[model samples]
Target: MAISSLQEHPGSEVTVWMADGIYPISEPLVFGPRELGEEGTLVFKAQQDAQPVISGGVEISGWIKNSEGLWEAALPKELDETSGFRELFISGKRAARARFPNEGYLRVKQAGVDRRTNFYFQKGDFPIPVNLEGVELVFLHDWSISRIGIQEIDTAADQLIAVDSIGARIPAFFTIDNWEPHPRYFLENAPEFLDADYEWIFLKSQNKVLLKLPQNVNPTNSKVSIPFSQGLIVVEGEENYPVKNIHFEGITFQYSKWEIPEKGYSGIQACHFDPRPSNEGWAVVPAAIISIWSENITFTDCNFRNLGGSGIWFGPGSKNCKIIDSSLKDIAGNGIMIGEGQDRIVNGQPWWKSAPEQVASGNVVENSTISQVGSQFYGAVGIWCGLTAQTAIKNNVLFDLPYTGISVGWMWSPEATPARENIISGNHIHEIMNILSDGGGIYLLGLQPESKVLDNRIHGVKVNAGRAESNGMFLDEGITGVLVEGNLVYDIAKSPLRFHRATTNLVRGNFFFSDDSNPPIRYNTTDEEAIEKVDNLFFSEGEPSYQKELSHAISRWEKKQRKKRKR
Candidate 1:
């Protein structure tokens, strides 16, 4: 209301000053076209020397020691029996959901006949909690993770049936394959599994939260926060009316949560999911702070942490937006998402190109630190840019991720689209590809002419639990006219550079080092003429000739495989 009234004076900027301390809101603070006038700017600025937090969490208190030496807390009066949360934070650290086999995963003995609703567990592998209510089965795919509720477990048959279908569309991705004869799985959210320290289970029927904490720590002194809302801010605008010129600074956005749908969270890749049938548009998990159809928006010196979903998103039609000097940590999904997912239909056909006015372009994320992401969803990336042009991702430090560090381009084929001239440069990316396979430190897909991947330091990409190999820079499928130069890629388990189904990519002046059986450069379904590699040094221990390097790569691979077989 104050912002609207302040807009009465045209051409004058409207400023909302937030003071230090936490400002909890029941719902997301929305800013739409109506909140922004045509000419002036709207600024949500923290006071000088102050850092304000916009939180969507409710603190739970009134703790008491239970008979089993666990701590229990009654729900607040404002909460009811339906208030079920999937995440809980104790003393600023995320507490594990009550899960069986607390340390690692249990392997499936055999995939079910349908392969979408049931699987056969090994003998004595079933968790068999006291009750199946509120229990979920988490299935780990090659590059994604699926969560579904348990409907029945026939111990006599060693089969477990899910309440809904698993969250994968393709059979090869979800079913048992030669690479993984038995998929990994775990069970969560049952009282019987709450035996480990910092594991918790909430009983909505009892209106209480049961927590297993350290014996020395008192529950009354610990700060327990449960997120009640999905998002903290939403900046949305229509096609014809776009919100513009808004800025947020010196703010910390935290404690947002996202619930799994009843059907399940079937992860596809990079946090995109197949919520419905195929050929329809897929869904990307929403973020804690989102902007859609907006322009000239900025978030400077902001912090996003302890979230149940992605940190920030610049959705469709967002232009000239920037997230500068920010830090994103402990995120459950992708750290930041830019642009829209592929397969959005328009006019009764699959939408392959963005409307000129609806493309998310000219956005930038610089000088940021993103770590400990993909905490809940293993397929999430640090930064995902899809079908956007002229987006600059620079000077960011990204590590401790489960999937790719940065992914640009969404189109899987060499088709014309509104994605070109994107830049990924000067980022320090390491310790990525730690969980999933078929991803790289920097992954480029589709046909992005004139795009550049330069000066990024990428390393520590080891082999993970997946069928396909990982790389330092994976130019996958239809990549063309991109210049890869001056990047230092090393310490990779597979290859430093890989090209699959790509053409005409210029690779020059890059230092690629590998200490394994894989070559520094690898090509699949691609011809030698397709990639122009000039002055690129390929080193295992020292720089070797390209021809000699190929033979050494084979010998090294054989040695590694022999070692693995003996193990």
Candidate 2:
């Protein structure tokens, strides 16, 4: 059969034939406004009757619209002994067991519809029961099949062949065209463009321009800006080259070892390093217009939304970097994560081993909002600081997360030097429930360096009552220097704040009200020592002056702690 582009038109009639002598009429395949083709009709017909056409692995070569409104080319169709193309010909009925082959992998073009189509055999339609272990699906385009599953290829006939590999069993589907590879260039033997004293170099590919900086690279005098026209620029570095720059205006960066598994390319990442001496001082810097990273640099005013892994990430050598004014939504992974590198691999250990040593210190995130994230088990967070130190988070809004609104420490040990010093303050957090093992508003476990929870609002947090426990905030073992103050907690199924062996933590001046009649606030210590019920104005309109005084005292204590650290 010759490959033909299928077009669907409204009210037009066409015929589709199956090997079982069944015939189905044509139907309209609508391609919406976002699709490439104009609305048209598609007709399918069975080949010869004796041929008993078994399109076991037929792939669509280009973009095709399925019966559904969604524009997708890659699908695995199912056919029975009586199912061959005959089943697809039944008029006015949606065809079952239809598979689209895997078209070869391709790069996403800038602004055109680059699509491929393929077909596959559906499980449970085979002539006999066959174990599809190692079936390989071959394609004319350059493509690699990652995984496959048997949806229904069960057959009663003994003549059916068992698939060798999972890939071979995949029904043919159409794929988009492959992306064009970028041209390569060598930088060997190039003359030293700038003085050897400079530490960083900015290269623009379109103009073939290289901006070199002296060893004493300082933002006070020097600034770097690369135009957007530069298509694909490469930044080469020596083994121990130090980066010194403040701005990379209108430039998209491709890092050394960045890749997206499905997409196959690192989109864009812009970075700036601090040009300060003493590489060891602990001070919070002001918000800047660009992304910044120091030995302990900080990132503020950098909006990271609609991008992969949005928000600022501090590497291991990045000692103290803070990310603020940044919004990370519609991306994979939690927004604003701090710890070690994103892809640090330990030699003989799991990937999580390198997590502790990548300590991000004295980081502060304020006034940011993350929402509507699209992952099964990941989503938005007001702030996330794991395996780092002296981090302050305040006045942020996080909602509609698949996990928790604010996640403090995961697999982080307070015993480690410069533990994740997470301070969650004055934030409005809600809608934190989905995963079974999730802690709602704020989740802290293992060893926490120092966590301060103050003046926050938590509402509409859902956790299974009796069967599971969810809290407005949770504190676990090895937790030290925790302060929960002046926060409003309501509509939580479980305890508002549950602390397990959290030592030296203070909970004061917080309002806790629940319509469940009796409020639950479980702690290891008594109300007088562990929690100070001072000046807590509840919905009942009762005021507690003692709680108010304690809240003030806790605030004073935090201020003093900040000052003492500065000293």
Candidate 3:
């Protein structure tokens, strides 16, 4: 149904209530400014106590076991392979694509011999059988990941060659940083690599899918789905006329997928998912929900899982949006974001300084749970805001990711902008930067005046031996006038708080503890003219407060087991 089809009655309202079932949409459901009713509000909500699912996938049924003992299902021949399907879900759970060694990754012997497109394996790393034709190598370095397709495998030399497009784009992957002989990559999505029961693979040319069923499990007992849509909903309003007063409640969105570029893959900031060999500059990947040039939107009591890119993106010019009491799990990128547009830096000046950046402001993400994000791209965060102002991220739970939990600001310099006057408080964050390093539970960048980090609980940041250490809160490059107060951070690898070139900030009433003998804070600069610390802060005294620290600083996983035993 088109938004123009909505009847407009003067001084009246409109509500489109959905029922409890799955509504799979192949194309993006776009809402423009005309969607506004006569009373200027539109509510696309689920019926009370009903769970409506708006999915971006199709159900695949009629499964039978092949002669080779793998579950085989016929796929639709009409399904487009140009933008291939990359994710699979069975019985409401995500299943991993076929991979080898089952548990850990294989070490690399060499990045390549003066080449940017090949990786040589260690002596026992690339066995003859597992190094096959269609296998992909998923590389994990400091704060970035890339999934590159294998073009050729030389069993004689234990080397795998990639397509012409592997590392040509990102400077980190091809041109600059090197990851020679690191145990940071794993091979995925190959038949030879499918040793586990929960693993699956798809062959588009054959119009078939293959899976190894777990013991006592069969395809008949599962509801398998393959993602085919990149975006489920898009709200794009015109420049001056904005879509306003829209709300979504009690809806579940699942199974959106990302396809690798034909020229292979590279890494960019926020782990850009666009395939780029032919295309030069950065392009924004689609999300499950995107709002651009809109206002006064709310998404409450919703569930988002098995996603490809970001769960929700409030693009530039979008403001006054709320996402509350929601859950985002197993996502490929950020859980929620605002003000993600193009950024260009040249000759020590940003493009926004000259072009007058469009900032999304007054967004709130509160009382929500965001976990297992940055699944495909480990460089993103749970809640990310760039050039956004007056955003409040409070009372939330963020965990089980590779990178930072909440990231604010885009610029790295001290130039003032609207990305300030934000508040981050009353949140519980743990188990962060599990794969990627050089991040923290909460990370702030650039200049954000009147921004405050208050009353949050953070812990469980371990060191990734080869990468830069992790922290609880990081004020990086040109942070000024931000207030840090009443935060409890403990059990981390390094200092709980670190500031780089930070100046004139109020840091007080924050509790800090670490398992090792390092200080609770690391001030990277001697520019005392810029920062204020050592005031009203409590470190682990190893005596009176140590017992209190045990319960507060205890890991959440251990805490859960203790509660279970008590019951």
Task: List TM-scores for all candidates, in order.
Answer: 0.92, 0.46, 0.90
Q: What is the lDDT of residue 132 in candidate 1?
A: 79
Which of the two, 1 or 2, has more TM-score? 1
Cα lDDT, model 2, residue 271: 12
In model 3, residue pairs whose N, Cα or C atoms come closer than 3 Å (at least 3 residues apart or on different chains), thus clashing, are: 503-530, 504-530, 504-531
* Cα RMSD for candidates in order: 6.8, 25.9, 4.4
Cα displacement (Å) at residue 566, model 2? 25
Error of model 1, residue 120, in angstroms: 1.5
Q: Ten consecutive residues with minimal summed lDDT in candidate 1?
A: 170-179
Residue 236 in model 3: shift from native, Å? 0.6
Error of 2 at 437 (Å): 4.9
Model 2 weakest 10-residue run by lDDT? 264-273
lDDT of 3 at 87: 75
The candidate that wins on lDDT is 1
Tens-digit lDDT track for model 2 on 235-288?
111113322211211111110111112211111111111112212211111111
Better of 2 and 3 by lDDT: 3
Sorted by TM-score (best first), the order is: 1, 3, 2
